[model samples]
Target: MKPVRIKRRFSLGLGGFTYLFVTSFIGLGAISSQTNLLFWTFGLMVGGMIVSAIYSTAMMMSLRITRVLPDHGAVDEPLLIRYELTNRKRMIPAFGLVISELDGDDEYLRGKPHGWVLHCGPRATLQAQTVGWPTRRGAVHFNRICITTTFPFGILSKSIVVTQPGRVLIYPKMYRLRRKALWDIHSRDMIGSRNSNEGGGSEEFYGLREYRSGDSMRHIDWRHSARAGKLVCRDMTRLTPPKLMLLLDVRHRGAWPYDTAERALSFVASLVVQAYMEGFDVGLAVAGTPCPTFTPHHGRIHRTRILHALGELDFKTDEPGSWSTHRARDVNWMVIHAGEIDELFGPPGAHHLSDAELDQWKLNHDGKSSRVNLVTRPRRGVLIADFSEGVS
Candidate 1:
């Protein structure tokens, strides 16, 4: 591991700049009027600005910075990246220190990429945090960690740039999926495949939320709602969904629209998560993009493997999508952009989840949608993510 490099920088803040302007004005007046009071005030203001700048810069330079990346980062979710600052000097202490990310062109960071710390004793290590919500799924590379401060008088701001090479793999955003008709239909096929005593059989009380349109009246928490003065519906997670294999059939027309592809990938990620939670064996078959072959299986490892393939999905937009035309046995395929399946094996579609229907289903509109699901729609004229050319 190469040693981290730290560089210190300083600049005049708004207050410092105003102080300079006032000092100049006062000095001019002093010279014109030959007034000792004005001259004294001008010299004091200039000295104060200088003292503020020097103090802030010295404190910033004395600190050594390091960072801690999360185990895994997901798209559009708050991921806390930690920073540790070590005050190297034996006599001096650090105060009002902040750690920030040095981002490039990607604008996924929601708020200002900085975290604050009240104080750090001499030779003590202090921890701070910066929150980053990845807008898209992929590698989040950190070129540097910027530690900035405007301590004491707050007249000048100083920044210390540390060349820290850090990056993390971020999974695609999982959407809330309430639609269970497709899963219930295929679960019967999986019946007797696993012993009744082996898998999760009964529904468990999960959480409480606002009542939806089609919720069972028996499931409603009447007493709790009456106490809280609102209709609170009871949510549960005791039932399993089903096993599914995703067959992606997409073809690039000309140029790949970035927006369209992102939305499509997000949709896939959401489905995989919902299935896994419901104990579904999830797999993938992409036509164009070069991704790993994930056989249908159920488990945390299997889900990670599928998500890793989705994150590494990258290819020229002009190149059409490709996948083995041969179909897998003993598995129900969930077709996304999969072309006509005349020569293919398995059912044409165990469940055809139309993107249009997903878009039409307003999840927030009292519909019985799953809390752990994703909802996204591609822009007009935007198409193709791991798809091949021409009609399937």
Candidate 2:
């Protein structure tokens, strides 16, 4: 570690002036009156200030500070960052080390103590810990770190300012769609496959079969026909359906409280876990950014990848326009918002539904809409239960 050179600034102000006046006046009076006791009193006051400054300065000099950031942290999730202060020199004991992170607009501030102080023996190292919670998703940059000390007496404060730059990238929250919604989407794809042609064209050749009357002439294998002395055709297509894409809407209209959004996000994460378990090719799409589409796979590795993304989700906007308008029409969409559903999704010309009407609307259309359904819509002011406990 490089040595941090710190300059000390101490102001005596009114207190120092008072100390000087009282001590000097006593010393002068002792000289005139030939009193040795008064002289000793003046000398003691002067010696205490000198001794305090040297002790505090030496304490600050012997200490070394370093920060440890968490490997992973979610948006609005509390994370611990440790600041280690090691006492390098054996001569001085470390005392009253105050470590604080500077406040900034981009920084997330917690009301908890920003830094800690500790006493250290010769060659002993002490660690100070602070907690950070992210308010929004993005890259969080911490540019300033301060370590200071006011040991023994409060007269002198020695300090160091560190410009260590670090950042944490936050991804969008992963949400689980309603099982009814997921089933409806999955069923739609399965039903579509029934009407489509069964074999050839797109699927890999499965080997030669005896030619049937309906078999296309192009599928006839000339080489096989010559070898077997019988007409044969290759099966070119299989009956497998296209993979279902799961699109998650993570954007909200107004500035909802941080806790409210995080709770909603955690719910989404649970949904993704459930979907991955069921062996669906689960792709993720946030409202704003282009997410790497996960072509759904079953097994433990796929589930881990989905959960990793969910753990780092942020809700701040990075793109323009409403997400509803930009949503992909082909894939199934599941939206998680903090406010009114009708305000977010109702037709442009229709009047916004009243609270009573909205409740009735959800009752009638919940789990029964074509193409799309409001799976966990709230009625009145009641919040929906988390999706992990099974959708109600």
Provide the overall lDDT of each model, using Cα atoms, as 2-decimal numbers: 0.65, 0.55
The top-ranked prediction according to lDDT is 1
Please list the residue runs of candidate 1 whose C-alpha ends up more than 4 Å from where it truly belongs after superposition: 1-3, 31-34, 110-112, 179-182, 188-242, 252-260, 315-328, 338-350, 360-362, 365-367, 370-392
> Best candidate per TM-score, number?
1
What is the alpha-carbon RMSD of candidate 2 to the true structure? Answer: 11.0
Query: Residue 11 deviation, candidate 2, in Å?
Result: 6.0
Task: Count steric clashes of candidate 1.
Answer: 17
lDDT (Cα, tens digit) per residue for candidate 2, span 66-137: 766665555556767777778888778877777877643245434433767767777987777987766555
- Residue 114 displacement in candidate 2 (angstroms): 1.9
